[model samples]
Target: MKPLYRGLASATRRKASRFALETRLDAMTTRLKDVGEFGLIERIRRLLPGAPDVDVIVGIGDDVAVLETGGGSYLLATCDCQVEGVHFLWDTTTPFELGRKAAAVNLSDIAAMGGAPRWALVSLMAPQEILVESIEELYRGLGGALAEAGAVVVGGNTAKSSEGLIVDITLLGRVAPEHLLTRSGARPGDVAAVTGTLGDARAGLELWLRPESGVPEEEARTVKRRYTSPQARLLEGQCLGRCGAVHAMLDVSDGLLSDLRHMCEASGVGVELEVERVPVSPALPAVAAALKADALAWALTGGEDYELLFAVSEKDFPRVADQLLQETGTTCRAIGRFVDRDQGLRLILEDGRRSSFDAYAGGWDHFKAT
Candidate 1:
C-alpha cells in the first residue's frame, strides 16, 4: 500500500500550483476533444499516484480509492461532479433534486464496493446570479440523502464559476477486508446481474430533451422524478457484499453495456448479455413508445440510473438474488454471464442474434460523437 503523501504533490514542492495563472506548457498540447474522456483519464493515470504505492490499496482507477490507514477497515474515497447543463437543468430539476442526485452518484460508488458511507465533502462552483435559497435547498437535499446512509458532510468549498453551476462531492466510506468487492473479481461463467429497473433516468432525461415526444402526463411525471432524484442502493449493495456470493460489483452510472465492458476489462474476462433480460423499467416502454425511441437501447446504453450491477456464479445467483430481495426488498435481475477474455463484449438480441455489433457503440463517452 502506498501512503497518501505521494497521491498529491506538496504545496511547497512547486513554486506555482497546477492551476497557476502563468503555468507553462509543452510546445504541442492536444485538445481534449481529440483525447476523449477515458483517454484523458489514462494519460492522467500514468502521471498520478503510480499505483502499487504504500498504503494505497487502490488508486487512480476503479470507482473509488481503497486506502489502508492502519485502521479496522479499508478507507474508501470517491467523488463525482454534477454540472448544470451536463447533469441537470433548472427547467426540469429543482435545486433540491439536483443536490440529491449529485450526492446519490457518489453514494452509488461507495455502494458498489458494499461499503458504508461515513462522510462527504461537497464543493460548489456557481455563478453570481444563483439565489441563496436555491443553494440552501440544494444542501438540504444533499444533507438529507447523506443522513439516510449514515454519512455526513464535514466540510467543502465554494467558488464562483464564470460558467454553469457545479456540485462536486467527495465521499469516504469503510469496508471490512472480508467484505470488500471490486470490479476485478468476476470469473468466466459468473452471472451478471443488476439491481432495480433500468432506463428510467434516461426516459426522464428525454422528457426534458424531447418535449414534443408527447409522453403522457402521468408517465412523464414518473420518469422525470426518477431522473431528477436517483436512489443509491446502499442497503442492497451491503447485503450483496456480505452474502459472499457476488463475484464483482459496480454501480450503473455508465449504462449496462458500457459498465459491463468495464467489469469485463477489469476482471480480465468477457460478457454476453441477453436483450430480453436487461430489466427495462416499467416506466420506460410507454415513454420510449411515445418518443418513438427504443426502450431496450435506453436500457443498454443510457447512463445515470445509479443501480448496482454485479456478477455471481451460476450456482449462487438464484440464492444471492433471493437473499438480496428478501433482505433489502429490492429486486435483482441476472441479465448476462461472464465469459473468457477472448470473447469480448457480446450481446443477444430478441431474434437470437449474438453480436459485437459495430453499429451499436456501447455507451456514453464524453468526448466521442454520439
Candidate 2:
C-alpha cells in the first residue's frame, strides 16, 4: 500500500512538472478548439508529409489512403469512429443502429474510392456495465451491413470506456488501377455531380432533435431511416469507376459544399454550384416545413448524406450518369462545375445572384463550438 501511494505521488509530481512546462509553452501552442479538426489535420500532414516524386500514391488529405502492392489493384484503407454523446444518444439510437452506422461510414470511404470492400477491423469501447447481449446485437448489425458488401469483420480490439460507447472501424478494399478515382483528379470545367439525393439525413436528425415538430409518421420514418442506414453508393461508385468517365470522386459525408471545398483544394480548382439544381430528397421539404426551417440551408450544410459527389467532363457526364442509373438503379445530378483556381467556390442562387461560399464556416467541426 505504501509503494502504491508512492507510485501515485510520483505520477502526480510528474504530471505537475509537465503541466508547468506546458504552461511556459502555452503561448506557442494553440488550443485544440482553436485549431479545429481540419486545421489539426493540416498540421499533422506537415509533420509527416507523404513522399514526393510519386513515392506516395495518396496521402493524408484524402478519404482513403491508396497503397501500391505490386498488383493491378490499389489497396484502399480508411477508418471512422462514432462517439456516444458527440455522434448519437442512447435515448434514441439502438445498439444495432449504432453498429450499422459505424460500419456504413467506413464503407462510404471505400465507395468514394470506387473500391470493393473486402475486410474490416472493428474496435469498440463500452461502459463496463453495458450488457453483453447488447454487444452481440451490435456486432450482428455491423456484420450484416458489411456482409451486404461482401466484407467481413476479421478482428478487433475491445476496451472499457469511462463514459460512452465508441465504435471505430478500419475497412480494407481494392480497386483496379484504371478505376481508382481520387479527389485530386478533378479538373477545371469538370461537371460536378452527386449520387442519390441530399438533405434527407440531416432532416432525419432534425426530426429526432425536434420530436414535437409534427412531421407525419411515414415522412418521419423515411428521413429517420436515411440517418440510421445510409446506403454507401458502393454500386454507383463502382459503375462510375468502370465507365472511365469520372475524373474525381468522394462521398458526401461532410455536406455537399464542405466536401466540394475539400475536392477543390485537393484538385487546385474552384467551383460554382447551381443552387437551384441541388437535389433535395422528396421528404425533406415536408420535414423542413414542419420544423419551420429553411430547406435549402439544410441541404447545403447538412452533412452525413453519404452519397457520392463526383466530377466528369461535360461531354462524358451524360453517358456516365446514364450508365450509373442503368447499372445500379441509382440516379445522379449535376449541381456544379469546377472552375479556374482564381474563381474560388461560388453559388448561383435561384434569383440568378452569385455569391461566394465560405467553406470554412457553417460546416461540422469536431472541436468547434456547437
Candidate 3:
C-alpha cells in the first residue's frame, strides 16, 4: 500500500512539472505586432518550403516571382491585399475606385518586374450584410483597370467575413528572359533614377484628410485624383527592361527610401541620394506650403505612388533617359547613384551637406504602431 501511494505521488509531480514548462514557453513567445511586418515576413520566408524547383528563377523576396515558362519567356506572378480601414477610407472612395486600386496594385508588381500583365485572379471577403450592387461596382472598376493593362480576370474566390471588405488579387504576366529586371543587378556605379513625380499621392491624401486646411479646391482635386487613381508604369517598365541599360528595377509602392534600401540590400551595394533631385509634382509644393510640411519629407517617405525606381548604368543613363522620355512620355530623372557598400546609405541635402540616412529609416510598416 505504501509503495502504490508513492508511485501515484510521483505521477502527479511529473504532470504538474510538464504544465509549468509549457506555461513558461507560452509567456516567452513573441507576438506578431512585436516583430513588425518585415520581421514577420522574414520569419515566414525562412519557414517556407525548401528550395524552389528549377523553373523558379526568382522567389519570395522579389516584387514578383519569376518562373520559367520555356520559349525564352518567364512568368511573373504577384499578389496584393487591401483591407478597408488599413488601405482606404470607404467614405472617401467609391467601390469602383477601390476595385481599380486593388487591381492596379498587383499590376504595379508585375510592372516592377518588367512584365506585361495577362491574367488575374481576385478574391473578395465581405460581410453578408454588404450590398450586392456595391460588390458589382467594385468588380466593374477592377475590370476597367485590368482592361487598361490588357489583362482579364479568369477566376477568383469569394467568402463571407465578419469584418470590413477585403480584396486580394493575383496577377500573372510574361516577360522575355533578357528583359527581366530584378533588384539584385545594380552595380556600384549605376545611376539611381525614378519615373514621374513623387509625393503627389501622399499630398493628395493629406488634403482629403484635412479639407479645412485651406488647400485650393482645384489643387486638392488634382492631388486627390492622383491618390485615388494611381497609374502603373507598365510601358516604362517594359521599355527599360528590354533596353538592357537598366540594371535594377522596382516600383515605389513603398516610400522611395524604403524601396531604394531594398534594392541596395538585394544587390549588396550602397546608395547616395541627392535630396533636391527628387522630383515633386507642381501641386505638391502648394499642398506642403499650406500644411507647413516639407515636401521633400513626403517625397522621401510617402508611398503608394506606383512609380518605377531603377538603376541605370552610368554609360547608358543619358541615352536611356532620353529614350524613356520619348517612348513613354514619362520624365525619368537621375536622382542619385549607387556606391560601394562601405559608403553606406547617405543623403546629400540641399545645402550640399551629407547626413546619415538612419534618421529617415522609416516607412509604412503594416504591423508598426500607428
| Candidate No. with top TM-score | 2
Model 1 regions lying over 4 Å from their true place? 1-29, 49-51
lDDT of 2 by residue, 141-241 (tens): 89999999999999988876769899999999999989999988899999999988899999998888888889999999999899887878898888988
The candidate maximizing lDDT is 3
Q: Score every model by TM-score.
A: 0.90, 0.92, 0.92
Of 1 and 3, the candidate ahead on lDDT is: 3
> lDDT tens digits, residues 1-370, model 1?
3446545766745665565433356436566667887888899988775546688887876999999987699999999999888877799888998888888999999999999999999999989898999999999999999999999999999877768999999999999978989988999999999999999988998888887787788888888877888999999989988999888999999887888888888899998889899887677999999988899888888888899999899999999989998999999888988999998888888899888834476777788644
Lowest summed lDDT window (length 10), candidate 1: 19-28
Error of 1 at 95 (Å): 0.7
- At residue 17, candidate 1 shows an lDDT of 56
Please give the CA lDDT of all the candidate structures: 0.88, 0.88, 0.90
Looking at model 2, the pairs that clash are none
Better of 2 and 3 by TM-score: 2
Worst 10 residues of 3 by lDDT: 1-10
Kindly list the per-residue Cα lDDT of model 3 for residues 66-176, writing each as its tens digit: 998888789999999989998988877899999999998998888888899999999998988999999999999999999999999999999766589999999999999
Per-residue lDDT, model 2, residue 233, is: 82
Total clashing residue pairs per candidate? Answer: 9, 0, 0
